[model samples]
Target chain A: MSFDTELAEAQSAIGDGFDRLFAATPDLPLHRAMRHAVSGGKRLRGFLVVAGARLHGAEDALNPALAIEAIHAYSLVHDDLPAMDDDDVRRGQPTLHRAFDEATAILAGDALQTLGFELCLAPGCHPDAAVRADLAFSLARASGADGMVLGQALDIAAESAADPLDLDGITRLQAGKTGALIGWAAEAGPRLAGADIAPMRAYAQALGLAFQITDDLLDHEGDAGEMGKAVGKDAGAGKATFVSLLGADGARARASQLVDEACDALAPYGKEAASLIAAARFAISRRS
Target chain B: MSFDTELAEAQSAIGDGFDRLFAATPDLPLHRAMRHAVSGGKRLRGFLVVAGARLHGAEDALNPALAIEAIHAYSLVHDDLPAMDDDDVRRGQPTLHRAFDEATAILAGDALQTLGFELCLAPGCHPDAAVRADLAFSLARASGADGMVLGQALDIAAESAADPLDLDGITRLQAGKTGALIGWAAEAGPRLAGADIAPMRAYAQALGLAFQITDDLLDHEGDAGEMGKAVGKDAGAGKATFVSLLGADGARARASQLVDEACDALAPYGKEAASLIAAARFAISRRS
Candidate 1:
């Protein structure tokens, strides 16, 4: 099957899984808010888990795939809080805090986070308990102060810093913010299979950077109508990004180079890893 | 040793452990806020873990013990948010959000939550991978919507309800809000040792109720200066509580009875569980 077909299939499967998970719970407003926050997404992170696990011959990747998606959704919800990015809209709809109340939104995000860990630790995610523990451990690092949260802290600190972040500073910031989770997703197959993760790890590091640069490129040049949420948000906030530090053309070139590097790191997997390679290519080419 | 001696020792050890953990992290404001939030607790939950694990002959309880403590601290920090309880004081000091900005407080709580899971998943927590996974999995339920978060949501919902909660409603609310984590802590030893959890589970259930009743009694009768925060806040808000529904004397009687049941449930351990027996007794007797 083509990469697009596989990606679309994975997205559908993950979404269905989440729908089932949510349906099992009581229909409290908090549950409703969680459903609202996690409703729709491209499911790229989920795709990474599913596709990567497939490469390693793991049959039950759906739980971990949905787990990563849940974490991604929770992070987005919290990031969009009034005191954070203060985003009014997400995925072309009102943000959770705006749709519900601030307290409900906060609780929804918190519950979603716990749900992520629960899914990862569930027996369905992987047969090996050690693998489950490893996933939880790696996820905590990716999402905690060492990774995504730390990146957010740095980003917030940068907004008021006397000196604008240079290319290196921005690169470090984006690595923690954007790269860590992606890195974990790409390595999921190896983690579940108890296989060597070096190749996938290297691939993910490059792919993550490419993904962030493409985001910068989209913000710099993509039309707002095509991008769903407002474009130029990073620039508007006066925050330094890949585009700001490296220029639009330079950023695009860099993203292309990283994509190549990402694909090359998967040489050991050869033809079996075609979907992952396509994903790296799609990271830079998509408008949204 | 008496429960008092054991509890004091556990508190000191847990505090030192947290201090070391925080000291190793970068000196960011978020890290500082996390440190502040985790400081000066009585470490009752930590004691539960250590004492329970020792009963089951599990040598390495510190990691899981601290993990639960981290989760508790994170919950408290978020609970004190302006959007939630809006309290400015905790443990006789300014709350995390008050000492720092709201965004920092939110991030600190988020990071601390991740840290809790991280600690549980670490090899040091348990030699067996299955044990680590179990800890993480059980924690998600206790701390998430099914447990603590659900309790808080119900409490919030109750505040705005046209009708105040009856005894049953208040009991269910407190079960979720306060009972979950305490239950998790009390059962940690069996979880680590892969022993039968029925007895410990029963003990925890009764002890948790006793603990909450004591809290209500303290608020109703103790001085604010002694409690380290405002007293009579629950009654002031007109929220239904065990004390409100059972009446002051009735509540005290119920607490004592529950404490007796808690100790009775630990008969399986007999003389080996003296400290736990003391812990049950201490639950209703604590002034703060």
Candidate 2:
């Protein structure tokens, strides 16, 4: 199958799974908050999880893919809270607190986070509980203070700074905030498939860096309508960006270089990893 | 050892473990939040955990005890948030958000929660990864929306009510908000010890109910100087309480009955559960 066909199939399946899951618990106001926050994203994290599992020779089952995506979705919801990013919109829709109340938004974020672990720990997944534990641990680390939370704190601190941020500082911030979770999705596949994780980690690291640099480039030049979020937000906020420090053309070139490095890191898996490589390239090349 | 002596030992051990754990990660601001929030309390929850573990025939290890207490402390921190309880003081000290900023409080709560699971997943614990998974899963559920978060939402909704709450409503609210976590701690002992969990669950359910009722009673009549918090705040806020609905005398009788029921539930385990039984009685009788 073509990478596009596979990606579409995976996205459809995850979207359907999430809809059912949210519908199953309709009485919870927090569930509504979660649905609002999660419904409109492009499912990049979900795609990476599905692609990673495929690369490690695991089938794209409903449970694992949905669970990983739920974690990603939940993180975004909380990360966009009034106290965090204070974002008014997400994926072209009003943010959770804007759509609901702040209390509902908080509860929704908390519930969705629990839902991620619940999906992994639910009966009838892989029989090995160790693997389930490993998946939960990885997601927790990615979302917690040592990783995404720390990155967010840095981002907030950097927003107020007068000095220009260095490449290393920006990279470290993205690695913790974005890269940690993306790397987690990739590493999860190997852990769940009972495969060695070294190569997957390498691929994940390169892909994460590529993803962030491309995101920076897109924010600089991409259309707000196409991207589904306000473009030029980083510069307006005085936030650090690869394009700000490295110039637009240099940033674009660096993104392509990172994408190539990401693809090369997946070479050991032969055709099994082709979709993941393609996805990494698409990640850097896409407008949004 | 007598229950009092054993409780003291447990508190000291937990204090030492937390001190070392906080010292180990000095760089993160969240770690400082953990330390500040954790330092003031009487360690009642820590006592319950040690008491529970003793009932299940587990040796008192600092690790599992610390893990459970860490979760307990983190919950208190989050529960006191402006969006949650809006409390400024706890145990005569400023709450996490009061001591630090709201962002720091949020991150600290997030980090401490993850730390709880991380401690459980640490390699030195028993090698039964399934059991560890179960422990982590249980803690997550008890702490998350289906448990404490739900109770908190209900509490917020109830805050503006003029009508006095009935016994059933208070029980349901406290069960999710406060009881579920205490129940989890009781069950944690057997799960960590790899013992049969049936009796432990029974003990936990009774003890949790008893603990909340006792808290309500204490909040009604206990001295503010002794309790380290303002007493009569529940009645001042016009919040529903067992004492409010049942009258102070009825509430006392009910609390005594619950203490008896809690002690009776532990009878099947013989003297091994003595500490737990005594702890249950002490939980009800103590001023704070």
Candidate 3:
């Protein structure tokens, strides 16, 4: 199948998986809010998980995919809180806080995060206990104080600081914020297989940086209606983003270069990593 | 040693464990907020974990104890948010949001929750990978949508309901809110040893109800200065607590009966379980 078809199918399957998961939960307001928060993402992270798993053998990546998506959704839920980003819209719909109340939003975010770990540890996620532990441990590292949250905390602290961040600072911050989970998702297949993750790690690091550059580019020169959220937010806030530091053309060139690096890193996997390569290319090509 | 001494020691050890854990983190506002949030809890849940581990003979329950407390601290941080309980004080100190900012409080809570999972999955937590998976999986269930958060969500929903919750409703809510984590802590030792959880489950259920009853009783009759939190708020809001549903005398009697059940359930452990029995009794006796 074409990469787009595979990605679309993966997204559809993930949506179905979530439907089954929440079907077991009571149709309460908090749960509904959780469902809403998880909905409408491009499912790129979920696709990354499946793509990684496919590079291995017949491992069930569904639960891991769902797990990563749950974590992503939880991050978004908190990020949009009034005290945080305070965005009113996400994926073209009302954010969780706007849809429900703030308390429910916070609870929904917390619960979704727990659900991510629960999914990683569930029996169906992996047959080996060691692999399950590895998944949960790696996920916690990617999400916790030293990883994703560290990046976010740094960014938040910098917002009130007098000096604007230089290139190294922004790179360090992005490494924790967006790149950590992206790297984890990319390595999920190898992690499940107990395979060496060096190649996947390299591929993911390149892809993550490229993805962020593209994101900054989109924010610098894209559309609100197409992106399903506000654009130019970084520039509007006078924040230092990749585009702001590198110039839009420089950012685009760097994204292209990183995409090539991502594709090159998958050389050890031979022809089977074509879709992953496509995913790297798509990261830079997408509008949103 | 006496039960209070043992508990005080456990609290001290857990505090030290947290210090070591945070020592590795960068000294940022978020990490500081997290430290502040976890500092003042009674560590009842952590003590339960250690006590359970002691029964299993030298299981090194410190990691699991820290994990439980981390999760507990995370819950309290969010509970004190302006959108949630909106409390400015917790454990006689300014709440995380009050001490730092709301965004930092939210990030700290999110990171702390992840830290719980990280601690449970660490190799020091258990020798067996299956056991570590079990620790993380059970902790997730206890904290997630189907567990403690479920109870919190239910309580939030009821706050704005047209009618007050009856006895059954309140019982169900408390089961998720307070009872779930208490039960999990009680069963931690048995879970580590792969022993029967039935006795611990029974003990925890009874003790949890007794604990909540006493909490309601304290809120109804105690002083805020002594409790270190606002009292009579449940009564002020016309919320039906155990003391409201069952009058103060009735609540006290019920708590005493539940305490007896908790002690009786520990008959399986016999004389070796004296401290646990004392812990149960202390639940009803404490002023805070």
Write down the C-alpha DockQ for each prediction: 0.85, 0.53, 0.93
Residue range B167-254, candidate 3, lDDT tens digits: 8898889888999999989888988988888999999999998998899999999998898888888899888899878899999999
Native contact recovery (fnat) for each candidate is 0.76, 0.46, 0.89
Clashing residue pairs, backbone N/CA/C < 3 A, model 2: none
Cα lDDT, model 3, residue B47: 98
TM-score rank order: 3, 1, 2
Cα deviation of A150 in candidate 3 (Å)? 0.8
TM-score winner: 3
Mark the regions of model 1 whose C-alpha exceeds 4 Å error after superposition: none
**Residues B163-245, model 2: lDDT tens digits:** 65577878888988888888877787888788877776777777788778778888888887787766887888888888888
The candidate that achieves the highest lDDT relative to the unseen native structure: 3
Single out the weakest 10-residue window by summed lDDT for candidate 1 chain B. Answer: B222-231
Per-residue CA lDDT of candidate 3, range A162-228, in tens?
9879999999999999999999999999999889889999999999999999989998888999998
What clash count goes with each model? 0, 0, 0
List the candidates ranked by DockQ, beginning with the highest: 3, 1, 2
Compose the digit string of candidate 1's lDDT tens values, residues B1-288.
Answer: 888899998998898899889878988898989899889978999999999999999977999889999999989988999899889888899889889999998889998889999999988887899999999999998999789999999988999999899987878888888899999998899999999989999999999988998999999898877777768889999988888889999999999999899989999898999999988888888888
Show where candidate 3 strays beyond 4 Å: none
Q: Residue-wise lDDT of candidate 1 within A190-254, one digit each (tens)? A: 89888888998999999999999999999889887677666888898888989988888899999
